[model samples]
Target: MNRYYWILGAFAALVVLLAVGLNLNPREVPSPLVGKPAPAFRLAVLGQADKTIGPEDMKGKVWLLNVWASWCVSCRQEHPVLVDFSRRGNGTPIVGLNYKELRGDGAIDMRRVPAEQEVPMALERAAGWLKEHGDPYLLTAMDIDGRVGIDYGVYGVPETYVIDKAGIIRMKHTGPVSPQVLNEKILPLVAELNK
Candidate 1:
Protein backbone atom coordinates (compact mmCIF):
# COMPACT_ATOMS: atom_id res chain seq x y z
CA MET A 1 0.00 0.00 0.00
CA ASN A 2 2.84 2.45 0.77
CA ARG A 3 4.55 1.73 -2.57
CA TYR A 4 1.29 2.27 -4.50
CA TYR A 5 0.72 5.60 -2.72
CA TRP A 6 4.23 6.80 -3.69
CA ILE A 7 3.69 5.90 -7.32
CA LEU A 8 0.41 7.81 -7.40
CA GLY A 9 2.03 10.84 -5.80
CA ALA A 10 4.78 10.84 -8.45
CA PHE A 11 2.25 10.59 -11.23
CA ALA A 12 0.27 13.54 -9.86
CA ALA A 13 3.42 15.66 -9.64
CA LEU A 14 4.28 14.91 -13.27
CA VAL A 15 0.78 15.86 -14.32
CA VAL A 16 1.06 19.21 -12.52
CA LEU A 17 4.41 19.94 -14.09
CA LEU A 18 3.15 19.13 -17.55
CA ALA A 19 0.12 21.32 -17.05
CA VAL A 20 2.30 24.28 -16.09
CA GLY A 21 4.58 23.79 -19.07
CA LEU A 22 1.67 23.51 -21.48
CA ASN A 23 0.21 26.78 -20.25
CA LEU A 24 3.35 28.69 -21.17
CA ASN A 25 3.69 30.13 -24.66
CA PRO A 26 6.01 28.11 -26.86
CA ARG A 27 7.59 31.28 -28.24
CA GLU A 28 8.38 32.40 -24.70
CA VAL A 29 10.34 29.26 -23.87
CA PRO A 30 13.15 30.43 -21.59
CA SER A 31 16.57 30.27 -23.20
CA PRO A 32 19.70 29.91 -21.09
CA LEU A 33 21.38 32.35 -23.51
CA VAL A 34 19.11 35.20 -22.52
CA GLY A 35 20.82 37.99 -20.52
CA LYS A 36 24.14 36.66 -21.83
CA PRO A 37 26.29 38.31 -24.44
CA ALA A 38 25.11 37.70 -27.97
CA PRO A 39 26.94 35.02 -29.87
CA ALA A 40 29.63 36.35 -32.25
CA PHE A 41 30.13 35.42 -35.88
CA ARG A 42 31.46 37.00 -39.08
CA LEU A 43 29.84 35.64 -42.20
CA ALA A 44 29.85 36.70 -45.81
CA VAL A 45 27.35 39.30 -46.84
CA LEU A 46 24.46 37.75 -48.72
CA GLY A 47 24.89 39.79 -51.88
CA GLN A 48 28.57 40.56 -51.64
CA ALA A 49 31.02 37.74 -51.06
CA ASP A 50 33.89 40.14 -50.36
CA LYS A 51 32.10 41.75 -47.40
CA THR A 52 31.47 40.28 -43.94
CA ILE A 53 29.45 41.35 -40.92
CA GLY A 54 28.86 40.26 -37.34
CA PRO A 55 27.83 41.36 -33.87
CA GLU A 56 31.29 42.87 -33.35
CA ASP A 57 30.63 45.41 -36.08
CA MET A 58 27.38 46.49 -34.41
CA LYS A 59 28.77 47.23 -30.98
CA GLY A 60 27.51 50.31 -29.09
CA LYS A 61 24.17 50.11 -30.89
CA VAL A 62 20.86 48.62 -29.88
CA TRP A 63 19.86 46.29 -32.70
CA LEU A 64 17.87 43.27 -33.72
CA LEU A 65 19.41 40.09 -35.06
CA ASN A 66 16.83 38.20 -37.09
CA VAL A 67 17.59 34.62 -38.06
CA TRP A 68 15.76 33.69 -41.22
CA ALA A 69 16.08 31.34 -44.17
CA SER A 70 14.60 31.36 -47.64
CA TRP A 71 13.20 27.89 -46.96
CA CYS A 72 11.37 28.88 -43.78
CA VAL A 73 7.66 29.44 -44.29
CA SER A 74 7.40 31.24 -40.99
CA CYS A 75 9.99 33.76 -42.15
CA ARG A 76 7.74 34.87 -44.97
CA GLN A 77 4.93 35.38 -42.50
CA GLU A 78 7.06 37.64 -40.31
CA HIS A 79 8.74 39.55 -43.17
CA PRO A 80 6.15 42.23 -43.69
CA VAL A 81 6.27 43.19 -40.04
CA LEU A 82 10.04 43.50 -40.22
CA VAL A 83 9.76 45.46 -43.45
CA ASP A 84 7.43 47.91 -41.77
CA PHE A 85 9.72 48.21 -38.79
CA SER A 86 12.64 49.02 -41.05
CA ARG A 87 10.68 51.57 -43.01
CA ARG A 88 9.77 53.31 -39.78
CA GLY A 89 13.45 54.19 -39.30
CA ASN A 90 13.36 53.90 -35.51
CA GLY A 91 17.18 53.97 -35.42
CA THR A 92 17.22 50.36 -34.33
CA PRO A 93 19.25 48.39 -36.87
CA ILE A 94 17.79 45.07 -37.94
CA VAL A 95 20.62 42.73 -38.85
CA GLY A 96 19.70 39.63 -40.78
CA LEU A 97 21.24 36.17 -40.40
CA ASN A 98 20.25 34.19 -43.47
CA TYR A 99 20.35 30.68 -42.09
CA LYS A 100 20.50 27.31 -43.80
CA GLU A 101 18.89 27.00 -47.21
CA LEU A 102 19.22 24.82 -50.27
CA ARG A 103 19.52 25.40 -54.01
CA GLY A 104 17.27 24.73 -57.06
CA ASP A 105 13.93 25.32 -55.35
CA GLY A 106 13.75 27.73 -52.43
CA ALA A 107 11.27 25.30 -50.89
CA ILE A 108 13.96 22.70 -50.23
CA ASP A 109 14.84 22.86 -46.54
CA MET A 110 18.54 22.56 -45.73
CA ARG A 111 17.92 20.41 -42.63
CA ARG A 112 16.05 17.87 -44.73
CA VAL A 113 18.81 17.60 -47.31
CA PRO A 114 22.60 17.76 -47.09
CA ALA A 115 23.84 20.98 -48.64
CA GLU A 116 27.12 21.01 -50.58
CA GLN A 117 26.75 22.04 -54.21
CA GLU A 118 23.64 24.02 -53.24
CA VAL A 119 25.21 26.72 -51.05
CA PRO A 120 26.31 29.15 -53.74
CA MET A 121 23.02 28.69 -55.49
CA ALA A 122 21.21 29.24 -52.24
CA LEU A 123 22.93 32.58 -51.72
CA GLU A 124 21.95 33.66 -55.19
CA ARG A 125 18.38 32.57 -54.55
CA ALA A 126 18.35 34.46 -51.24
CA ALA A 127 19.60 37.59 -52.93
CA GLY A 128 16.86 37.34 -55.54
CA TRP A 129 14.22 36.71 -52.89
CA LEU A 130 15.20 39.82 -50.99
CA LYS A 131 15.22 41.84 -54.19
CA GLU A 132 11.71 40.68 -55.06
CA HIS A 133 10.26 40.92 -51.57
CA GLY A 134 12.04 44.12 -50.58
CA ASP A 135 14.92 43.72 -48.16
CA PRO A 136 14.39 45.04 -44.64
CA TYR A 137 17.80 44.26 -43.26
CA LEU A 138 20.42 46.91 -42.60
CA LEU A 139 22.79 44.17 -43.77
CA THR A 140 22.11 40.50 -44.36
CA ALA A 141 24.80 37.97 -43.51
CA MET A 142 24.95 34.49 -44.95
CA ASP A 143 25.36 31.50 -42.64
CA ILE A 144 25.82 28.95 -45.36
CA ASP A 145 27.64 26.42 -43.18
CA GLY A 146 25.24 27.06 -40.26
CA ARG A 147 28.07 27.25 -37.70
CA VAL A 148 26.85 30.71 -36.75
CA GLY A 149 23.33 29.36 -36.34
CA ILE A 150 24.63 26.76 -33.90
CA ASP A 151 26.52 29.45 -32.00
CA TYR A 152 23.27 31.40 -31.62
CA GLY A 153 21.47 28.24 -30.42
CA VAL A 154 18.98 28.49 -33.27
CA TYR A 155 16.52 25.62 -33.11
CA GLY A 156 14.76 26.87 -36.21
CA VAL A 157 14.67 29.69 -38.67
CA PRO A 158 12.66 32.88 -38.05
CA GLU A 159 14.04 33.42 -34.54
CA THR A 160 14.87 36.97 -33.44
CA TYR A 161 17.15 38.43 -30.79
CA VAL A 162 17.00 41.95 -29.43
CA ILE A 163 20.42 43.11 -28.26
CA ASP A 164 20.91 46.16 -26.08
CA LYS A 165 23.49 48.86 -26.73
CA ALA A 166 25.77 47.04 -24.30
CA GLY A 167 25.58 43.97 -26.61
CA ILE A 168 23.64 41.83 -24.15
CA ILE A 169 20.82 39.76 -25.53
CA ARG A 170 17.72 41.09 -23.85
CA MET A 171 14.95 39.15 -25.61
CA LYS A 172 14.70 36.12 -27.88
CA HIS A 173 11.53 35.34 -29.78
CA THR A 174 11.46 32.00 -31.54
CA GLY A 175 8.90 32.10 -34.33
CA PRO A 176 7.19 34.50 -36.68
CA VAL A 177 6.89 37.99 -35.27
CA SER A 178 3.25 38.81 -35.73
CA PRO A 179 2.02 42.37 -35.43
CA GLN A 180 0.69 41.66 -31.95
CA VAL A 181 4.04 40.40 -30.66
CA LEU A 182 5.89 43.28 -32.26
CA ASN A 183 3.56 45.82 -30.70
CA GLU A 184 2.94 44.22 -27.32
CA LYS A 185 6.31 42.71 -26.47
CA ILE A 186 9.19 43.68 -28.76
CA LEU A 187 8.58 47.37 -29.36
CA PRO A 188 8.12 48.25 -25.70
CA LEU A 189 11.21 46.31 -24.69
CA VAL A 190 13.30 48.03 -27.39
CA ALA A 191 12.06 51.42 -26.21
CA GLU A 192 13.02 50.67 -22.63
CA LEU A 193 16.37 49.19 -23.55
CA ASN A 194 17.33 52.11 -25.78
CA LYS A 195 16.92 54.45 -22.84
Candidate 2:
Protein backbone atom coordinates (compact mmCIF):
# COMPACT_ATOMS: atom_id res chain seq x y z
CA MET A 1 0.00 0.00 0.00
CA ASN A 2 1.32 3.50 -0.90
CA ARG A 3 0.37 4.87 2.54
CA TYR A 4 2.23 2.10 4.34
CA TYR A 5 5.39 2.74 2.27
CA TRP A 6 5.24 6.48 3.05
CA ILE A 7 5.06 5.77 6.80
CA LEU A 8 8.02 3.39 6.59
CA GLY A 9 10.08 5.96 4.71
CA ALA A 10 9.28 8.64 7.30
CA PHE A 11 10.27 6.32 10.16
CA ALA A 12 13.57 5.49 8.45
CA ALA A 13 14.36 9.19 7.98
CA LEU A 14 13.61 9.93 11.63
CA VAL A 15 15.92 7.11 12.72
CA VAL A 16 18.71 8.47 10.53
CA LEU A 17 18.25 11.96 11.91
CA LEU A 18 18.41 10.76 15.51
CA ALA A 19 21.53 8.73 14.80
CA VAL A 20 23.31 11.68 13.26
CA GLY A 21 22.29 14.02 16.07
CA LEU A 22 23.49 11.71 18.81
CA ASN A 23 26.73 10.95 17.02
CA LEU A 24 27.53 14.64 16.67
CA ASN A 25 26.96 15.35 20.34
CA PRO A 26 30.25 16.14 22.13
CA ARG A 27 29.35 14.30 25.32
CA GLU A 28 29.35 10.92 23.52
CA VAL A 29 33.18 11.02 23.26
CA PRO A 30 34.42 10.81 26.82
CA SER A 31 37.71 12.71 26.51
CA PRO A 32 39.96 14.14 23.83
CA LEU A 33 43.30 13.79 25.66
CA VAL A 34 44.19 10.75 27.68
CA GLY A 35 47.50 8.87 27.85
CA LYS A 36 49.47 11.73 26.33
CA PRO A 37 52.09 14.17 27.60
CA ALA A 38 50.55 17.54 28.35
CA PRO A 39 51.71 20.47 26.29
CA ALA A 40 54.18 22.92 27.89
CA PHE A 41 53.67 26.67 28.02
CA ARG A 42 53.42 29.60 30.43
CA LEU A 43 50.40 31.74 31.22
CA ALA A 44 50.02 34.54 33.74
CA VAL A 45 47.76 34.51 36.71
CA LEU A 46 45.77 37.69 36.58
CA GLY A 47 46.52 40.24 39.33
CA GLN A 48 49.60 38.30 40.37
CA ALA A 49 53.06 39.78 40.06
CA ASP A 50 55.90 37.22 39.43
CA LYS A 51 53.92 34.00 39.59
CA THR A 52 53.11 32.80 36.10
CA ILE A 53 51.59 29.26 35.93
CA GLY A 54 51.80 26.67 33.23
CA PRO A 55 52.42 22.98 32.34
CA GLU A 56 56.17 23.38 32.91
CA ASP A 57 55.47 24.51 36.46
CA MET A 58 53.43 21.35 37.07
CA LYS A 59 56.17 19.06 35.78
CA GLY A 60 57.68 18.44 39.21
CA LYS A 61 54.41 17.53 40.91
CA VAL A 62 51.28 15.49 40.38
CA TRP A 63 48.50 17.99 39.93
CA LEU A 64 44.90 18.50 38.90
CA LEU A 65 44.58 20.74 35.86
CA ASN A 66 41.09 22.24 35.96
CA VAL A 67 39.97 24.27 32.95
CA TRP A 68 37.28 26.72 33.91
CA ALA A 69 36.13 30.20 33.04
CA SER A 70 34.36 32.90 35.00
CA TRP A 71 31.14 32.28 33.05
CA CYS A 72 30.86 28.53 33.69
CA VAL A 73 28.26 27.92 36.38
CA SER A 74 29.02 24.19 36.38
CA CYS A 75 32.59 25.03 37.28
CA ARG A 76 31.21 26.57 40.42
CA GLN A 77 29.53 23.26 41.26
CA GLU A 78 32.86 21.38 41.15
CA HIS A 79 34.98 23.99 42.92
CA PRO A 80 34.69 22.40 46.32
CA VAL A 81 35.64 18.97 44.97
CA LEU A 82 38.74 20.54 43.43
CA VAL A 83 39.64 22.06 46.79
CA ASP A 84 39.33 18.63 48.32
CA PHE A 85 41.50 17.12 45.59
CA SER A 86 44.15 19.75 46.22
CA ARG A 87 44.19 18.78 49.86
CA ARG A 88 43.99 14.99 49.48
CA GLY A 89 46.01 14.34 46.33
CA ASN A 90 49.38 14.07 48.06
CA GLY A 91 49.22 17.84 48.48
CA THR A 92 49.13 17.86 44.71
CA PRO A 93 48.96 21.28 43.12
CA ILE A 94 45.82 22.50 41.37
CA VAL A 95 46.22 24.41 38.10
CA GLY A 96 43.41 26.57 36.80
CA LEU A 97 42.95 27.84 33.27
CA ASN A 98 40.56 30.76 32.87
CA TYR A 99 40.05 30.07 29.22
CA LYS A 100 39.34 32.58 26.37
CA GLU A 101 40.32 36.30 26.17
CA LEU A 102 42.87 38.85 24.99
CA ARG A 103 43.69 39.09 28.69
CA GLY A 104 41.63 38.69 31.80
CA ASP A 105 40.49 42.23 32.57
CA GLY A 106 39.30 41.45 36.10
CA ALA A 107 35.75 41.84 34.75
CA ILE A 108 35.75 39.40 31.81
CA ASP A 109 37.64 36.14 31.15
CA MET A 110 37.53 33.98 28.06
CA ARG A 111 35.16 31.02 27.78
CA ARG A 112 33.81 28.82 25.00
CA VAL A 113 30.45 29.07 23.29
CA PRO A 114 28.28 26.10 24.15
CA ALA A 115 26.48 24.08 21.45
CA GLU A 116 23.22 24.55 23.29
CA GLN A 117 22.16 27.74 25.02
CA GLU A 118 23.36 27.55 28.59
CA VAL A 119 21.58 29.75 31.12
CA PRO A 120 23.76 32.79 30.43
CA MET A 121 25.56 33.68 33.62
CA ALA A 122 27.85 36.63 32.89
CA LEU A 123 31.53 36.53 33.87
CA GLU A 124 31.07 39.24 36.53
CA ARG A 125 28.27 37.39 38.26
CA ALA A 126 30.31 34.19 38.14
CA ALA A 127 33.30 35.93 39.73
CA GLY A 128 31.17 37.20 42.57
CA TRP A 129 29.74 33.72 42.86
CA LEU A 130 33.23 32.26 43.24
CA LYS A 131 34.24 34.80 45.84
CA GLU A 132 31.18 33.79 47.80
CA HIS A 133 31.70 30.09 47.03
CA GLY A 134 35.56 30.05 47.07
CA ASP A 135 38.36 29.57 44.50
CA PRO A 136 39.87 26.10 44.09
CA TYR A 137 42.83 26.93 41.90
CA LEU A 138 46.18 26.81 43.73
CA LEU A 139 47.75 28.57 40.79
CA THR A 140 45.18 30.20 38.51
CA ALA A 141 46.34 31.13 35.02
CA MET A 142 44.45 33.82 33.21
CA ASP A 143 44.45 32.23 29.75
CA ILE A 144 44.42 35.30 27.56
CA ASP A 145 44.02 34.53 23.81
CA GLY A 146 42.55 31.07 24.59
CA ARG A 147 45.72 29.43 23.23
CA VAL A 148 46.27 27.34 26.36
CA GLY A 149 42.72 25.94 26.17
CA ILE A 150 43.18 25.22 22.47
CA ASP A 151 46.42 23.40 23.27
CA TYR A 152 44.68 21.36 25.94
CA GLY A 153 41.62 20.86 23.66
CA VAL A 154 39.24 22.05 26.34
CA TYR A 155 35.95 22.34 24.46
CA GLY A 156 34.17 23.65 27.53
CA VAL A 157 34.44 24.19 31.22
CA PRO A 158 34.30 21.95 34.19
CA GLU A 159 36.87 19.75 32.43
CA THR A 160 39.57 18.43 34.73
CA TYR A 161 42.86 16.75 33.87
CA VAL A 162 45.16 14.63 35.99
CA ILE A 163 48.80 15.30 35.24
CA ASP A 164 51.71 13.32 36.63
CA LYS A 165 55.11 14.60 37.74
CA ALA A 166 56.71 14.08 34.37
CA GLY A 167 54.01 16.08 32.53
CA ILE A 168 52.08 13.13 31.17
CA ILE A 169 48.32 13.48 31.12
CA ARG A 170 47.13 10.58 33.23
CA MET A 171 43.43 11.30 32.81
CA LYS A 172 40.95 13.79 31.41
CA HIS A 173 37.45 14.41 32.79
CA THR A 174 34.77 16.10 30.75
CA GLY A 175 31.81 17.92 32.34
CA PRO A 176 31.39 18.82 35.98
CA VAL A 177 34.08 16.87 37.84
CA SER A 178 32.17 15.63 40.80
CA PRO A 179 33.35 14.00 44.04
CA GLN A 180 33.28 10.65 42.21
CA VAL A 181 36.08 11.62 39.78
CA LEU A 182 38.17 12.87 42.66
CA ASN A 183 37.83 9.59 44.55
CA GLU A 184 38.05 7.25 41.56
CA LYS A 185 40.62 8.90 39.29
CA ILE A 186 42.44 11.89 40.79
CA LEU A 187 43.23 10.70 44.29
CA PRO A 188 44.29 7.25 43.15
CA LEU A 189 46.68 8.65 40.55
CA VAL A 190 48.21 11.09 43.01
CA ALA A 191 48.64 8.30 45.52
CA GLU A 192 50.42 6.27 42.86
CA LEU A 193 52.60 9.21 41.84
CA ASN A 194 53.60 9.91 45.42
CA LYS A 195 54.49 6.28 46.00
Which prediction has the highest lDDT against the true structure? 1
Q: Candidates' lDDT values, in order?
A: 0.86, 0.70
Deviating ranges (above 4 Å) for candidate 1: 1-22, 26-28, 103-117
lDDT of 2 at 117: 25
What are the per-residue Cα lDDT tens digits for candidate 2 across 1-195? 999999999999999999998879577366556778898778766446566776877668888888777657687788888766555545677777776532333453335545232223333433555577676667667665678788888876768888888888888888888788777866777789777
Error of 1 at 9 (Å): 16
- Per candidate, the number of residue pairs that clash is 0, 3
lDDT of 1: 0.86
Backbone clashes in candidate 1 total: 0
For all predicted structures, in order, the TM-scores are: 0.81, 0.69
Q: After superposition, how far is residue 120 of candidate 1 from its true place, in Å?
A: 2.4
1-195: candidate 1 lDDT, tens digit per residue:
999999999999999999999998775667788899998888888877789997989889999999988778889999999999999999889999988665323556656755555667878878988887789999999887678888888886789999998889999999999999999989999999988
